[model samples]
Target: MRVRLVEGASLPSYADGIRQVYADVFSEPPWNEDPSAGDRYVERLAADAARPGFTAALALGEGAVGGFATQGTVGFATAWTTPDVFPSGRSYGHVAEALGPDRVEGWLCGALEVDELAVSPDARGAGLGAALLSAVTEAAPDGRCWLLTSVHAEATLRFYRRAGWHQVPVSVPGRAGLVVLLGPGHPAARP
Candidate 1:
């Protein structure tokens, strides 16, 4: 697989492939998201990619798009602070508590927030996901990175654990499904 970075404005060309991979992957097991959700997600991707510090990594298999991961240092802050951008204030509130609201942005301000990582079913077990993850997060300032995923995805959790991601303990009532993880050497991991 060939992995490379695609920046803002240039991202739309690959939106369809990335959307297909996203729709397929998230539609399985723990997520089960609908096609319309995927459509909406794709529609928003271009705008999201246009954010300051946005970056995307594409993994191609035999010249065809097979997997992708995206990140934007500034976009995360926008999504977190802007109302309705994420559709769930409850989840962000939980995350803020876990990361310490006052210190959260200080820690993550320039850190890459891995927005999406998806690999086509056909490319599973090929290490494309890991490669893509590594590429996108490596682009972060100071190599600090974080992402959120379904706590119920055992296989997905295992993959991330094997990749050396450290899960942050979040003990919020009613917050059972989502998880936050920090990559190795993140500043927050220091203490």
Candidate 2:
């Protein structure tokens, strides 16, 4: 499998695939919700793709999208970023606070805030998820990275933990049931 940053019109193509994954992955209990949520999420992804600081990765096999990851910086100015795109006003404040004032100052300098990651069900355990992560991590502008996942997603939590992401102690307000994950220190900002 080859993993790389997609550019041009192809970005939207991959975004579409990611939207499918979002629908499928969150179709069950815990993160599962109304179809409008997934639709809104995809819309946000499209907007993020057009953002200046955003970065995305795609995994391909036989020339087809196998998995994908999308990340970007989070701060005061862009704190209202994701919701405008995806419209998940429900957990917006929780995520914004987690990725906001506290962590954004130093830890998230140029940080790659993982907005979404999804692997095809047929491709699970094939390292595609890890590959998608590696692509995002390696491409992160500041070396620092972070994400939020439901504690209910035990497997996903384990995956991130094994990938070297550390858990933050704070609980997301609306997403009180979830756990936050952060990556290593900022590349340029580190002494």
Candidate 3:
């Protein structure tokens, strides 16, 4: 698989691939996201692409168009700086409420927050997800990067763990627990 970085200026060309990967991955099992969720994400991607520090990693197959690979690889990852003034919309509020101001600021603010990562079911188990993750975060300021996933997603949790993300031990209060993970090289990561 060939992983390439797509800056905000180039995100549109890959929107369809990103949307498809997202829907394919999230609409199953733990996420069980509705079809409309993918539509919402594509819409959100527009605004998100304009954000400072926004970056996307697209893992493409040979001859793939816009990156929805027909050559047996399709995956992507998106990330951006955690804004100094984090928004309260979406699940950010839940994250803020769960971790509180101190942890939020100390651990998250200014870090590269991975917004989404997904690989087509046919393309998983081949290190594409990890490569896309690294491609998006390899240049994180001070090696500070982070992401979150549902506690119910054991497989997702394991994937991040294997990639060396350190899960914050605290449980996020909600219908489902949200687990925060610090990147491998994060200064605060525990041994």
On TM-score, the stronger of 1 and 2 is 1
**Error at 151, model 2, angstroms:** 1.9
Candidate 3 per-residue lDDT, tens place, 1-191, comes to 68888878787777787778888899998999996687789889899898889998888877545434575328888999999987787678888988899989988999999999998887776788899999999989999999989989999999999999999888776776788899998988966
- Estimated TM-score per prediction? 0.79, 0.71, 0.91
Per-candidate local distance difference test:
0.65, 0.59, 0.85
Question: TM-score ranking from best to worst?
Answer: 3, 1, 2
Which TM-score value belongs to model 1? 0.79
Give residue 53's error in model 2 in angstroms: 1.8
Q: Specify the highest-TM-score model's number.
A: 3
Q: Could you tally the backbone clashes for each prediction?
A: 0, 3, 0
The total of clashing pairs for model 2 equals: 3
Worst 10 residues of 3 by lDDT: 64-73
Stretches of candidate 1 off by over 4 Å are 63-90, 172-176
Residues 10-35 of candidate 1 have per-residue lDDT tens digits of 66676666667777777888888885
Reference-based TM-score, model 2: 0.71
Clashing pairs in 2: 40-86, 44-85, 44-86
Pairs with steric clashes in candidate 3: none
